[model samples]
Target: MQNKLYLDQRSNAFIILNLLMLWGWWMLYQLYALPVHYAKPYFALDKIPLYLEWSHLWFTTWLFVLLCICYLCTCLLLPHLQVAQVSVRWTLILSILGAGILNVMIYPVGAVDLFYYLTQIKLFAYYGENPYLTTFWPTYAHDELTPLSSFLSWPLVYGPAWLGLASLPIKFVGFDDLLTMLLAYKLFSLYCLLGCAWLIFKLLGGGAPGWYGAYVFAANPLVLFEAVANAHNDILLTLILLVALLGLRHRHILALPAFALAALVKVFILPLALGFAVALWRTRWPFRRIVGGSLCSLLIVFLLVAPFWGDGSIIERMQAAVEQQQTLRTAAPISLANEYAQTSGASAQQLEQLRIVFTASYGCLVLLALFFVRPLEHAMASIMLLLFLLVSSLFPWYLIPVFALLALHPRRLELGYMVVASLTGLLYYPLGVVAWQTEGLTLFQIQLVGATLLALPIVVFLVALLFQRRVELDQ
Candidate 1:
């Protein structure tokens, strides 16, 4: 590939990053203008117009279309900017541009987890109901309130700390409108993304491959769209997980709180937590120190969560949370079967039959991860993580941490995971925009399954090569 001037190792990367930023901001401005004019006026989704005069509906629609095109252009530019060895100024500019586009799109489309995050918090803010104890908005929907706006279910699927963080926006952002809340959540997410970048830079001397970092994350349209644009708390949690993993690599005791807190925000990190705890145990920490530390982490999360949880019966609410969140690790074979059984409308008898099959399949994967997969321990752990993303229920932003790992440690085999995952994550965006029944996922999404399978052979080949390298090193 012929490299462009100043765009290659020749000139600064800072320039391109900034240019992308401007492009992204312009797109956001267009997004903010649209719903005020069109959505509120015509659909009355918000019905009450706050920003623009409802009469400007026609103009708002035009502006929204233009912004979508502009956002697309920005996305295309990011990959190139990432590949270029640009100056830091351009990098920051690009970073902000990425952030701008993310918040802009998140404010409008309402896809991904952005919706669930807001509605859950709004319940606590508007009515003073405990998010942990709240049921579907059906109770509120009857008071002439639109269920569409007030309706949220299963907020407890989120770990407790997530509720607190989501609640923080309620104070400053206010319950005045969804836009207010959307931006607030995204602002927090922006902080997380920056922290992840800084952490990666600190860990790897000479910096993680700049272009590689940008290409995999900083500039990926899917990441921007799902994380910042959509307000998925999973994005924030993913960063915490990444930071914690990097800390583990460095054996930073201080950073353990971040990982523990991450698990508090989302319980999906159970295996990673267990893995680390076991590693720690092997290092001979006293029983009390290990037990107390883990318990103390949970207690801290509870203290933060205590203010929001009310309605007395704490244990009942806790029990309810446990029942509702049963399938969080759904990609695990047993959990996947349970989810499939529930959603596919199978009979209880059928479910019981399927459980046996699921248990057996999961046992096989566990065995592979533990033993036969020794050479690719890291890679196997990663596969288990990816399996957690698929087969199980997952919010799009949940893919962020694993993607960070891949971006930092990309072998040819893992890059294949990146490409497929990036596409699947992108597909999630349109679900909120296009009518679901109309956009019904096509077979192309199936293309990822193919990529995964074909890529496995390469993964196996890579494993062989790594073993060879290890033998040579031993000599």
Candidate 2:
């Protein structure tokens, strides 16, 4: 009886800690509003003065301490959650709802991609213009939202399915009011996030009675910030991908259309879809059935994209995507390489050539995995890991698919996810208050820091793999 009471008290504390973290995120994001406003119009304005006038270095130090504490608290709570099963389920649901509501009002962090999404929707739904043909910047250049023009210079490179999916709620809200349209998109993202949580719970329910995996995912600080606060469409992408996997698990071949739809949401899901298709084939399913599904998926993809396809514009859009991919630098190996080359005084032509080589090499690695990795979960994890390592640009939100895949097999990957995802939040430092005053760290320096942070996990994983191999050899 005494032990039971003690366990209940500990579980209560765990629930409170999670709720506090959600509230903390809301407060932290509010702090961004002042800084972001001051930096807008391309930093042509004065920096906002803080109460204590904190130095960038000191502020970053404190921020790191806070995040580390959050990570440690989360790690401590997971085991307790396993014991206090029923309580944890209610906590997960409450935490997600609380975070989603709070994030709806928070300032976007790291990137303003949300605004670009809105602009594309407005163009397609309201202006009756094909977003593929009209870049948001040129169309809205003289409009009231022109201050955002600087970031929307790039044309729509998102897939046709994304445009279609994004257009629905946008059309419902009507485009004359930007804030309402913004809220509509955010609400849509929130719906996807809630769906992901429920789906994860259903997927993992057979083995465990607890909401351990779902709690880790839904209540993850990075996931909350990216999925809810930033209003990224990646949440929607992950939702459809989960649908495909769930359908495949039930042996429903119609899952192929869902997978195709997922791919059309973003081409990034292609490798994972292919991996799923291969897994389906290995089950002794008939070749004709697989071929038929593939044909149907292809047809669906073609039909969705056909309306958006313009005279010679498809080639132009493809080129734009290639250019965008080549120039991007974020928390990935290629970003580090690209920055190293640039800081070494490499010319534009040399940087472009290097990007091509990096991309080609990354392609080969993914192809090897698609052919060799058999299990759908393992293959999806492998593909996402490759992306995390090889992509030229990665944001915290980019980790959603990875988090979803690893939630299925978190026994090994959860710790790595927590560490890396927590550190990835530091990417927003450049947008913070002190950063504007001090001009922040250079992009290359930030990449170096990220490389060092992520490399620790890479080394640890490789060492573990090598140790496991040695044990097998000894056996």
Clashing pairs in 2: none
Q: Write the residue-wise lDDT of candidate 1 on 102-175 in tens digits.
A: 45543434343455566666666677777677654664654322333422555456766777666886677777
lDDT of 2 at 79: 67
TM per model? 0.67, 0.85
- Model 2: residues >4 Å from true position, as ranges? 29-52, 55-68, 71-76, 82-86, 206-210, 342-364, 367-375, 427-443, 453-475
Candidate 2 per-residue C-alpha lDDT over 1-475 given as tens digits, one digit per residue, 9 for 90 to 100? 9877877787788787766666566556556542345225322112334434556435534554464466457656666545437786667567668877776665554457677677777778877877777776766677655675344667676788888988898888777776676677778888888888777767766434226666666666667667876778888888888887777777667678888898787777776766775778766666776787778888997898788789768658856865676577665787788888988999999988987887787788677666654345645766776766675466567777777766665654455646565554554443333343445687677566656555445435534534544565679
Most TM-score-accurate candidate: 2
- Candidate 2 TM-score, true structure as reference: 0.85
Model 1 stretches with alpha carbons more than 4 Å out: 1-89, 92-102, 105-112, 136-139, 142-155, 205-215, 254-256, 281-292, 305-346, 363-367, 370-391, 428-475
Please give the clash total of every predicted structure, in order. 15, 0
What C-alpha root-mean-square deviation, in Å, does candidate 2 show against the real structure?
Answer: 4.0
Give, for candidate 1, the lowest lDDT window spanning 10 residues: 37-46
Superposed by TM-score, candidate 2 places the C-alpha of residue 162 at a distance from the truth, in angstroms, of 1.1
